[model samples]
Every structure is written in C-alpha cells, then in structure tokens.
Target: MPSSNKNLSVSVIIPVHNGGESFRRCLSSIAAAVPPPHEVIVVADGDTDGSWCVAQEYYTTVLRIPVCSGPAQARNLGARTATGDILFFVDADVTIYPDTIRQVAIAFSCEPEVAAMIGSYDDAPGAKNFLSQYKNLLHHYVHQTACEEASTFWGACGAIRREVFFAVGGFDNRYRRPTIEDIELGYRLKQAGYTIKLCKSLQVKHLKHWGVISLLRADFFYRALPWTELILRDRQPLNDLNLQLLSRLSVISIFALLGAAIASLWWTALLGGVVVFSGVLLVLNAPVYSFFVRQRGWWFALRVIPWHWLYYFYCGLAYAIGTSRHYWRQKKQLAFGN
Candidate 1:
C-alpha cells in the first residue's frame, strides 16, 4: 500500500436542499483543507435559497433538480458525474475539519483493501444549546464506542471507492426522505463483501440545531419507525447504532415503567415496580450518563435524564407501531394473491 495519498484522487459530493449559512461554512471548510478535493460536485435539490448560485462562487460543479428530490437521488446524480478514485459524501450542514479530507484519503491509501469508511461528529458541536449538545454528544459517544469494522454507513461524513459504489447500485433511491438510506446502503455493501471502517479519528462538526418537536419528529418518524420496518424486512437484528443491544433493553425498561404506572392504579403495589424499572434503566445506561456528567458536569447530566428517558419511551412506541404496520402489510399482501 502506498504510504501517502499523493496518487489518489477524491471527489467531494454534497447534496443540499435550501442550504443557508451553515452550508457556507461547510464550503469554506472545504476551501481551507490542506489538500483540496480533486473535484467538488454540489447538487442543489430544488433550492430556492440560491444555494446553487453560492456553490458556483466556490468553483464547484453545481447541478440542480428543478423539483425537490431527496438526498439519495441528489447523491446518486452527483456520483454519476464524479470522476475521482473515491466518492466522498458530505452532508451540506456538516463542516469538515482542516484535515478531514486528508484523513479520508489516508484511510483509503493506507488500507488498500478497505472499500469504505465513516467518521463521527466532533465532541464539541457547533450549536452550544443544551439539547443540541446532548444529542450531538450522544452521536459522538456511540460512533466512538462502536466497532471499528463498521456495520453501517453514515452520509454525514463517509467515503467509498468509486467503482465499488456504482457496482453496488449506490444509495437506494426508493427512500424518498432521509430515513435509513445510508444504513441500507451499508447493509448492501456488506452483503457484497465490501469492508467499511469506522474511522473515529476523522471527525466533522455538525451544524444542526435541535429543538424538542423537530428532534422528536426526526427520531420517531424518520429514524425509529423506518428502521424497525427495515429490520423486519431484511431479517436484521436491532444490533447496531442506536438500535443496539443496550438501547433495546433501555426501550423495554421504559415501557415496563409505563406499564407499572398503569398497573399501580389497579393494585398500588406496582408503584414499587415503577421505581425498580427506573433504577434498572439508570443502571443500564450508567455509562452514557456518566459520559454526560464527565463532559458536561452534574447539573447538565441530571437535566438530561428525563429527556433521555423520553427518548426510550418514544422508541418503544415507534417500534410497536412499526412492527404492527409491517405485519399488516404482509398480511394484506398474502390475502390479495398477486
């Protein structure tokens, strides 16, 4: 394997909708990197905000879709036009570190056999608000602790060999919204025997701000529900990312606490069971909570508990709903013989 990335070429592909100031910073970061990308392809997917025009100012090859298409399509279009050894997919809202692309090129150049790799969000998020910090930090913790041999791909900061990407059909365009498109692509890549690495060292800064309603909507609809259906369809276990073993247990504990609360009304003894389940939850997730405390102090960690518990509660509910829908669709398909 070559020691340096001098011979390698990378094409950075960014898919944006209505990219605002954050997108500007992302482009600026690209400009500031030690070694610039071989080419920059920015796909503006039905942007009225003139993000496409801004992309032109940066000397990027800007492509536009008149009607709004999801990131999957946008990325695929960008990939089709790319002419580099590696296709580096970066989300528009994410800003890369000065050495981010260098790290990506190094990963590919040094590990000749690895076909893909993903990076995590930096511990220090761009947004300083409490919820944004907690959410982005949780993401950082998960990716940092996950197996180096990645089980899934993340579009926020991920790269793949160009030939291998097209050979596997790229991101599944059926996913109209941003739902598990990247994860599904990762699964397919693994099925085809391609290796993907979780390069924790190559971190990027997430520029998204989190609000209660937006966060919950994304978790329940865009993530949990679609994810549950995917697992059922593909016979995959809840064994990776946010749906890992510990998260499954946490979801169970949350629902059990709710059940105990309801039962306490009937017998009054189950009230103790509520406390027991809650304690079990706290113990089960002690590592993450401790992580929060270590990173943000006791007051912040304490404040995060109820929100974290609320996360589990909604996860459980979404799983229930997703499972029911999956079975119902299957039943209907069987009844109406095709």
Candidate 2:
C-alpha cells in the first residue's frame, strides 16, 4: 500500500440516459459526502428527459452525446475525461452514503495491491414494492455475503485505478447495452493479475424500482444469459458469486422438487420428494431465511419463500437458454467456416 501523505483525488463518473429526478438526487448525495470527490463527471447519453440540464446546475463537468450510446460507452468517455488517479463509477440511480468517498479513500490508501474494489447496496432500497424490494435486497445480501476476495466487478458502485483500467482497454464498447460489461472488465482485470475487493462496509442505496415482469426479464435475458455467454467465451472458472457450487446444488434441488411433483403418479413419491426438498431448502438457505426474517419479520419471511423459489426457477431457466444459445451460435459459426 502506498502510504504517501500526498492526497488521493477521487473522480466520480455517472452515466445517464433519461435518469430524471433520481439523477439529481444522486448528484446531491455526492455533493453531501463529507470528504467530497475531486471531480464529478456526468455523461448524458442522449438525454431526452432533461437530465443534462440538471447536470449543469451541479458544479460538475457534463458531457453529452447526440444519440444514446449505452452506459458502457458513456462510462468509457467519462473515464477518458477523468483527471483523477481513482475512477469511481456510480450509477445515476444510487444514493451515496456521506462517508462513502472517504471510505473509498481509506481502502485505496490501505491496500496498494488492491487494483479495484466495489461496494454493496445498503439494506435500505428506495422501492417499496415487493418485487423491487426483493430484487434489491437479494443483491445487497449476495454482495455483502460474497467472498471478500472477489473475482468480478459491479458498475453500480465500483472504483478502479485509472492506469490499470486503461491497461485492460477500459470497457469493451461493443456491448451496446449494459449487459455484462462491468463483469467482463472485472474478469479482464483478474486475468491481468490485478486484485479486486468487495468492500462490504462501503455502501450505497439503490433507487431503481423493479417491477416483477421487468425484473424477471432483465435477470433472464440481459444479465444471466449474457453473463453465461461471457463466462463460456472467456473459458473462465465459474467459482465466484452466484455460480458457486452451493448455488448450483440449490438450483438442482429446486428443479428436482418440481420434477418430483410433476411426476407424482404415486403418493409415496410425492411425499418423499416434498420432504427431501423442504429439508434441502431449509438446510442450504438458512442464512437467507434469517435475512428475510430480519428484514421483514418471520411472517413475511414465510410468505416470501414462494417468491424465492420462483427466482431460483427463473435463474435455472435462463442458464438453460444461455447454454443452448451458446452451442447453437458455435454450430452456426462452424457451418459458415468463420
């Protein structure tokens, strides 16, 4: 760790496309941080909702593109324009804790070997709906409990060293949408032998509202499928985050439970399958049940079990689709002699 007394300037980068009120609130919270960021860069990727105008009101550098170029490109542009040593990437919908920047400073100062690091979303999410709450809280729980020795990165609230970021070629601009851009960057960083830490203590509040349909769709199509393709394409080891052994086991158990129920021509089979399924879910996800109970009480926790089951089902479905697509695409390429 570089213990030089020289101050570390932090540049905060936010990319927005019609972020509206939440974008303003994000900037306001950034301004309220105790230590404050050295520079705040807001890139408006075709702002039709007037967020660009709001960016001007804040004492921040504002960049604009005529067309919506997607978040990856916007963040990349912001990175190029950033003058600070540390590039802190924050989503337009996240509210930073007052000490967030200060905490980031401490982490970088204390761990010189840590080339990049990311923080988890705080327990308090802005959305009050069940779908939004469940999705956001699940994210918070996963990141908070994940191995501190992280193998991937999050763009919602992550920071990286400027030199190392550029060395990895920043973000692959070919990702026209959010997709797995940040996670891909993290994989590259890891391949380059740079260390990334999941700073559980540092946190921010997620303000994006997630409807049930939208959440499931995004999880399946945008995140899970693309992320699966990325892993297979890179031939990277899938031992981190949700792809861990325990998670895979849980998915298998859930599917077995469903299959046993569907094929329950015999009463004995149904009873045996249900008992085994209940035992497995209880044993494996005791901590998750505890989290639900703590967050929304015992009654709500019991009620939310079905929803979590649905989540597992959808995740497995996405994995199957992604796997099929990957092989199909490869077959097509082979046929074409590419």
lDDT of 1 by residue, 1-338 (tens): 23344467889999999989999999999988879998999999999999999999999999999988799999999999999988999999999988877788878988988899999999999989999999999999999888888888899899999998999999998988877899989888888999999998989999999999989999899998988888788887846678779989999999999999999999899999999999999999999999999999999999889999999999889989999999999999999976
TM-score of each: 0.97, 0.95
Tens-digit lDDT track for model 2 on 241-314? 77877777788889988887877765655868977896897788888889989998898778678888787788
Candidate 1 Cα misplacement greater than 4 A, ranges: 1-6
Error of 2 at 21 (Å): 1.6
Q: Number of the top candidate by lDDT?
A: 1
Q: Best-fitting candidate, measured by TM-score?
A: 1
Give per-model CA RMSD.
Answer: 1.6, 1.7
Runs of candidate 2 exceeding 4 Å displacement: 1-5, 265-268
